[model samples]
Target: MKTEEVMSYYAHTKIEFNDMFTHRVPATINGMVHHSSTGCCSFVFPLSGQGYFTFDNVRYKLMPGMVLHINNTADIDMKPIGSEGCHYAVIYYDVEETVIAHDPFVISIDDYTTCQRAVEQMMKAFTTPGNISRVQTKAYFMQFISEMLVAHQRSKHVDREDAMSEALAFMRQYYQSGLTVTEVAERFNIERRRFAHLFERYTGINPSNYLIELRIQHAKELMRATDETIASIAEKVGYDDPFYFSRIFKKYTGKAPTAYRQCL
Candidate 1:
């Protein structure tokens, strides 16, 4: 079905959030419109059929067994995709600023399959007649969010540690005089080819790219904290030519040295 047609069905459905707001919607194959709410975020689960959602002007296709989190401040538009209409279980709850603050990472259901299952189960609880108490439903919803946050934090920690260890080690020893990949490999007592492979495996970037990131990160620090000229900063970061340094900096940060320094 066309998106506009799907939205028409969405207009008739009921939506409810425990201790929040409840709404019932009728099934349709037409257009759907959503407005931003200040009190809480919305969790949408597609139990059956297919649809598509638009957020911040980006379209994301929704399939069965998928859970979508719409932020409190985001505008959402959606509609069904084909002949079958979409069925969604939605829940909204007030979120304290402190709770939001604790969640620095944006949780994406795409990564973890376990979190997807949790959302499906929550939808099932909501759809079943008199199957879940208000308190139970709230607890289950919070538990699902908590689990996703925990998994995200764990994954980030692993990635950060791996990147920091290799990058920092390389920087501390060779920051003043830039070392080639072969030199770094020799220093670490490994073959050059293997060293490149290992560095990419651990850092999610090749050795050369990681080196550039390290240099640029340090350059930003110096630019903000010191009154050094761009030329001096470039030299200190192992780039002899300030122009070359500016090019690399702009590539990574989308700003020139002077503009980046001015921002700080």
Candidate 2:
């Protein structure tokens, strides 16, 4: 095809991201590593771990910070290159026929940590489409694609952590000041849903639950150590309603604040 003709044909091409998912496939036969499913243009990133990806008879060893772009209508297989297995994310998108990806290609990300964070945000939005506003999800997707496009073009190695230690410090300092998941996440420059997921990954507890635990812990200390009224204690511990705080306290400690105080 002539360059001008090809450009004309693709001028109005549209790309739609659809059916995105994260998967971990074992190295065994049950992993479906060699499965062949055609007609989908997909983007893949190795979130962590190492894997050998095979597409169109070309083999690529993909490690953390690596990305793969597979054109529509190609056969592909990916399995762990090491004994640890593989963990990765993929998005299958539809593009105009004339602009479909033709051959599988690999790209190295320069800022892998940032890209991984974007991918995590995208996956959280993808898996639970309604968890975030549509505009927020769309923004995440656009940023995700833009970052990958830059990396794909430059082929440089870059990576670092998202650095949530500041979040932890902030939570410790503000847990008694009406802390909110959304507020804390925003303070840390992360979307609420993604922050919740990453918080659990780090602390092994839901972020809301963690905040509740903090509140209840402080409430218990005041209940035992001071002559403060239940209502006063509630406000001190970040709850404005004494009755609600008592209810949550009982749920955690199996005794109402007054009852626990009396017993103590």
What are the TM-scores, per candidate, against the unseen true structure?
0.37, 0.49
**Per-residue lDDT of model 2, residues 1-264, tens digit only:** 222332343345666666567878765535547645546777788887667678777876665656777877667687674335688987776666726336666655556788888888877776564646445656676677777656543432111134355567666666665667876664444568988888888878888998899888888888888999999899878787889998999999999998999998
For model 1, the stretches where C-alpha displacement exceeds 4 angstroms are 1-28, 33-38, 98-132, 146-264
Name the runs in model 2 displaced over 4 angstroms. Answer: 1-13, 27-38, 98-101, 129-135, 152-264
Every candidate's lDDT = 0.58, 0.69
After TM-score superposition, what is the CA distance of residue 72 in candidate 1 from its true location, in Å? 1.4
Q: Write the per-residue lDDT of candidate 1 for residues 90-180, one digit (tens) a residue.
A: 5675543322322111232223556655656665566656745544665667666656555544443344345346445755546544545
Q: Judging by TM-score against the true structure, name the best candidate.
A: 2
Residue 235 C-alpha lDDT in model 1: 74
